[model samples]
Target: MITETRVKIDWDSLGFDVVKTKSMFKATCPIDGKWSEGSLVPYGTIQLSPAAGVLNYGQGVFEGTKAFRTVKGDVILFRPDRNAQRMAFSTKRLCIPEMDTEFFLDAVLKTVQDNIDYVPPYGKGSLYIRPIVWGTAPALGVRPVSEYTFMIFVSPVGPYFKGGVKPLNLKVSTQFHRAAAKGIGNAKAIGNYSASLFPLMKAKSEGFDEVIYLDAIDGKRVEELGSANLFIYKEGVIRTPALSGSILEGVTRNSVCRIASDILNIPVEETDVDITDVLKAEEVFCTGTAVVVTPVGKITYQGETTTINGNQMGSVTEKIRQTILAIQRGEMNDPFGWIFPVNQIFKR
Candidate 1:
């Protein structure tokens, strides 16, 4: 049986902390063209070569998703297959071996199952699943390693932003850009984030929650925030920068499009968005696996500031959040079949 004791959770505390748990699912890949036996083992890390390829060449990729508790004590993962497909795209960009979609999803499902008891209740938080694939082989020179290890782990997490979703203040930084045209911006790679820290810190210190990065080449089009995809609501229409080669094609972004059009009857604009126009939008926000949806209240452009929806959460934002959360908690009919069930009823 799993080992940790539950601490009588409040069932409404959506905070990010590791609930004491017994084991995590693990697997290893070797150059023998095979993956060894994967099993549920105590959570820990293994040794790696000091000169690993991942260290030298940044040969790694990862995907993030969550598993939420149902009303009946069941755990469910949201669109894990979509995350698997995105992981494949990330792996290919790094020249890492790809796990078949079925195998990838199976690994996540099994891992979440092993950690199901740790999933928080209805309003608390969900268990965060992280699947990382990195080159294991060591080489003095820079090149893709011959062997790679793809493994998965789970952690009980609260709302990523804590407390609640509030309108955010943004600082526009024209000095450094998040991603460039025809670059690795579209991939979920580690380096992409490693490069955003300094600038993000600067923005934070400058009285902003986040920095909206613009295109590097032209400095006119909006790309994305450090971690989420951006959106603009204007003229009774939602417009987001078209998925050019530079933006990560987000799963949440895709779902919002379908949800908006099919359920809310709102048409969306998918094309390049001018940074100025986006900042001046009536309603601006971002979406991702973590933040689900967030409203941008104000943008601090070059010496000028604009308030999107008066820096308040818009009506559309509330509707989207409610519908999405209802679907995730299994309280609403899932017309899209985005959830994957992971638990069985018990007599505890």
Candidate 2:
């Protein structure tokens, strides 16, 4: 049990930004060997070579998940194993050494335990956990490094959007492409995100919350939002873009589909979504670990605007959001076995 003195923080006012906690977990591996047993270290800057592989060739990948403090004060993680599986896929795609599932889960659990006091109170927000792996060896050659580093850090975050759960205005970008057809889009690689910075900034400057990226091949089919997966509720069916090689397989997106189909008893479909159809949907929303679920009020494509659900969050979106939040916070039964209690892993 974490019996340390709790840190004083204004949890309610927190945003989706980095607030450095007390400690983090780190491990390293050599080219010819396996990863070391990692240790928890005080949070600080890590020494990296200027010519490190991650700096030069962008040989890195990351995963985002959260730990919520239940109403009874027990901290629990939401689908961390799934995050580990996704990270493994990302590492393999980047030619980096894959981390063991057990090792990855341990690093995350210990990092959260080491900083348990920093977890925001129930209903305030959750402690966002980020695990990243990168090639650390310095070399001028454009290849995988002989050494790699894996680290996990936690930050208390409220919501990705400024006003939590409110509708957002998004713009469709046909010029900038988030990922290529045969590129590393499916992988949670660092390069994929770096490519989105420009388009995301452009959308935000135009008074939009985020940019909705279209397919690179034709720019007609919807790919996803810059930072999340897109979903639309139409004609009593919840639809989202199929996981093409160019779209990321989001953990929350999977959960939403399952919950909608099994729990909510709504038909769910994952297929190619055209921008034209999205503009006419009954309700539109985006899903991810950081945002949880955010309803889209309007989408502007090619100087045209369309409002969803009368410019408000629809009934279906609100119900799904509340159900997922309830399961995450231990306020309801987790029929899917998604919630893993921290106490079950580490006894007090």
Candidate 3:
């Protein structure tokens, strides 16, 4: 195992682009539950064969979330338990070792808390937590590797997009589909993201910031972005793509729905979102822990373009984003109990 060596950090120039933290937590898959002790070490590479299962068979899953500093000098983690459960779903689909829910949460909390200093100030930015589980053994054939590893780390991140809260233009990819219907579309697995790199780049080169992937089967319905789940707002109501077994069950997406209904008194509709409807939507936006709330201004389809209402974050969006931010900052009342404060730690 490698060790995390502390280095000088340029906090003044930090953005949400690269990994800054040097330390991470790692634990190997326990054969028959005979797990080895975990460790907090330098964030570095793991030894693997050229014919590793992950290299050939693409066996892996991942998760993304953030920890933020509250207004009152406290660190809070936005809904973390949901991340654990989602990992379970990803593991089940990728044939990886079942991560014990309790253990998973415990490890992640400890990992983030250990690097609390890496967490930025209340308003500057946040600590991004990325947990990855992957097969380690080298396998030339198409089979699950017997050995696996799980690790978590933290890095302070700024606005996910280069510009802050700027409206984005997206393109509908009718050629390359995001995910297969029954395949790993819903799972936050490695290959799923790997498959997106090409099409996303093509869309980027085509003068769009993001590519909106459609269902592979028919290519008529909307799926999601390369990184986050999508939501559409219009006519005093919010709408998003339903979990069609191809859409990842996004934690932030769910929270937005709850806030819209319980707090804002707006109805949130989760169902099949027709690409054409979103094109004609009064407002279009996407949500995730990283992106937060980003409004879509225009979508370029072939040669035609459809503009969302006002081409800016709507009033409802502003309200919900502020509400959620307040909850994270421990400012307003947490009526829904979405934020989880760290109270325990795992000492080495």
lDDT of 1 at 147: 83
- lDDT, candidate 2, equals 0.91
**Candidate 3 clashing pairs, residues 3+ apart or interchain:** 3-42, 4-42, 282-309
lDDT (C-alpha, whole model) for all candidates: 0.80, 0.91, 0.82
Off by over 4 Å in 1: 1-14, 17-20, 30-37, 343-348
Pairs of residues at least 3 apart in sequence or in different chains that clash in candidate 1: 242-271, 297-311
Q: Arrange candidates, best lDDT first.
A: 2, 3, 1
Q: Measured by C-alpha RMSD in angstroms, how accurate is candidate 3?
A: 3.9
lDDT of 2 by residue, 308-345 (tens): 89999998999899999999998999999898888675
> By the lDDT metric, which is better: model 1 or model 3?
3
TM-score of model 3 (CA atoms)? 0.93
Question: How close is every model to the real structure, measured as TM-score?
Answer: 0.92, 0.97, 0.93
Output the lDDT of residue 32, model 2: 66
